[model samples]
Target: MSSIFKWEAKPFFDMVTRRQTLQAISTTALPALAGCTTDILDSGKSQTRYTLNIEPIEVSPVEHALFDPDDDALFGNPAQTALAAILPDGRHTTYGYEPLPDDAYVEYEGSYYQTTNLVTGRKQMERTLIRAEPLPDKADVPNDAILVDELNRPAARVVKILHSNAVTGGEGNSAELLREDAYVLRRPVERESRLATGELDGRIVTMTDGGNWAYRLHVTHKRITETAHTTLAIEVANSHSQFRDVVFGSRIDVELTPENLSADVRNLLEDAVRRETYEETVPLPETFEALLTALGLKAVDTAVTGKLLWYDGELYRCALYVNDSS
Candidate 1:
């Protein structure tokens, strides 16, 4: 397949926990774990049964020249063969020579194909369009906000931490919260190559389309290290298997760079960026509770009050996390 729903790829997650089980979606019935218990889903209470199904997206050698700034992208494939018009008798030919609907199929040589997507090739009609976005810098936390890889390594540059908002008991007034991260790479024909965080059981992600590339979008969160008086650590990385216990003066010196991200992780991030872009807005806070469950994150110290989401180079206020560490 070419793409997935908005919440398919979870960037900031550790799926190798002892509390999860693998299940086949097609063979077995999916449990209704949407709102059962946050303990197992969030704070690692019991265990979770979830997996990520990721697909690669095609990216033009040149950036999207016609895509709008507000538009988010998941994936794209270039239309080959010249345009054509479908005749009442099933004949197909080039455009401008004959009037035709945007979605009409065209013929080339001896074969017939669909018309090119709008604003491309002929720059006329709308094609398959969706909404997707990858990691963008948060305007509030320009200095503190950092982009990391799947290994929780810094994928982008190190911004100065002007004010700490990714800390406990604080509003994200000026924080570049981790919202979405894009991974670009070859199509994940194998299980390990796919953009997955939790239990993926035995599903296969095959790239059937001629499009050779793939992209995935992920909303990953970095580990939060808080001290009673000061914030010690706040960076995205898959360093620890789980959230490190709230430590007092000690801070783990993570020196990982973007390149340090595993090949699969990086590919997942890029693929997310190329998939799609949409304009519909959802209640992030209300949906974030389930989102954390999907990602397999637990709450520590204090219960989750609210979250900060990074999108379109801005941080949006979001929902609370887990209630307890089960």
Candidate 2:
């Protein structure tokens, strides 16, 4: 975004345009690979290393169940499914860092409704949403359940659906995707997109920022035709606040698997990956477990390690996967 200083000149990265992005990975120091979509071909040299870690985020049992996503149970209907289709992987799956701060509301097309019968004096419960939120964040909202943000801008769909019968009152069940990994208002979707994700079912072991800036990467896996892409929704609260456009683009590959990983780490990865097929929001296998972990991630991270290398002279971003059919 800034012209006064170039990315290759500086020690960090910034959001870059397609023209500004280079196809070559410069190697004055560390042996590196090239391109955002290219496979990692550098065979490990003096590349910058970042260790992947996942710590437990504190939450009440009730809160955890309410906010966390379900792995096995189908979490959406036709409307919910339609809306989720437009989301960029990590946004729908990424957990909220904060508990929505109470008083806050998201755009929701879903709500609890009950109908009463005049003759029998009976009540029936149902869940429904017609069109759904327009933008990935929120665009032209046609649903009454859709919500708006502080600026009255359209926001993510968060619905508290109710279920009950004519006899019982109702119970609340929410189908929400708390996509707060990035600053939705300040850094809108237009400027950012999912890059790559390196995940394992249990623990994630990959490269990090090497301790310059604190960042959170919400990795999302996407399959395009025959190519598998791991998109990273990188959210950073950087200490360096001068630059507004910061983009860390790179790839992530599962370097090691459970069979080749440390015994303790392997057990955790296997358990987390397998358990997800039937459940959601599991306990952390190990604090700061090196490598990768996430949904559909177990298929990628079975006893694995992840390595990331940034191009040119920049650091921060890491390596991800690209399924090579040939």
Candidate 3:
């Protein structure tokens, strides 16, 4: 419970506080204009539902580790036991031997037990070797093998913006784009802790079982900010013979670092993305529509596009050709 509390404290606080404030403000302000156009909002023509499409988001410059509860449980346990083989019936027992009493011999009926060396008196028990099978040998490997697997494995990730107006269907703006298809590969990976104080990486990760200690991986959504405005640079180029607006199914998710994202444009992006992604089908666009409905701005609506990149710790080098933003 303490761990869960710690893991989700910020999100919970943000949600609770925001809800209380909104409720209080709505209560104070609603009655003033309560009767004006109240029924008009529910009318079919005025209440058109818009689909929000989001792009798949990736953790840029993938980090080394994350928090793993499964590994913690396994490694935290103190008592360690291993199944060992016992010798055959033709065994000799010297002094200090603790033989199982005939009445106490129900469990391991055909097995023989010998006592430990009286000098240490560790109460060690030895069984006669029957036919214990050994585990197959695995070749030596490194913990960083997942880096190779990511290139091959089929993975699911979330890509969309997050904002207050995303799912809330009122007269307010929409949500912002943050991430896409955010998912874990098989088991998550981990490593030594390296996060800001009071913050933890709760992403499940995994690695090849070679080293003695299983290292977990931590990944957090990061933003490059220069003050109040958050910035995200995307690379787009002209791919076709001429400039054109090509709208493929897309969505984006944005997770603020320390959960502090306060930008109208960013929020709109998230809302639009969420609405698009939560749809049964995503529409296609040939020309970039800057003012698609009353939603957010299309930052990049170029025909020539760059390759979709993942976290590999290198500058994403690709062509750039501008297209219509409106």
Clashes of 2: 33
Summed backbone clashes in each candidate are 46, 33, 77
Q: Candidates' TM-scores?
A: 0.13, 0.16, 0.15
Q: Pick the candidate with the highest TM-score.
A: 2
- For candidate 1, write residues 1-326 as lDDT tens digits: 11212332234135433233223322222332433344346555433222222222133211211121221111111111112122212333322122223433332333323332222123242111111222223222222222222221121111111112223223454333321211211111111222233221121111112211111223232333221111011122222222121110122111223364555544443343343211111222333333333323223222332232222222222222222212
lDDT of 3 by residue, 211-291 (tens): 221222234433322111111111121332111111111111112221233355345445544453321111323222322
Q: List per-prediction Cα lDDT, in the order shown.
A: 0.25, 0.25, 0.25
Off by over 4 Å in 1: 1-52, 55-85, 88-101, 111-326
Tens digit of lDDT per residue, candidate 2, span 6-84? 3363433255444454422233222322332133343332332222322222432222222223332123232233224
Error of 3 at 89 (Å): 72
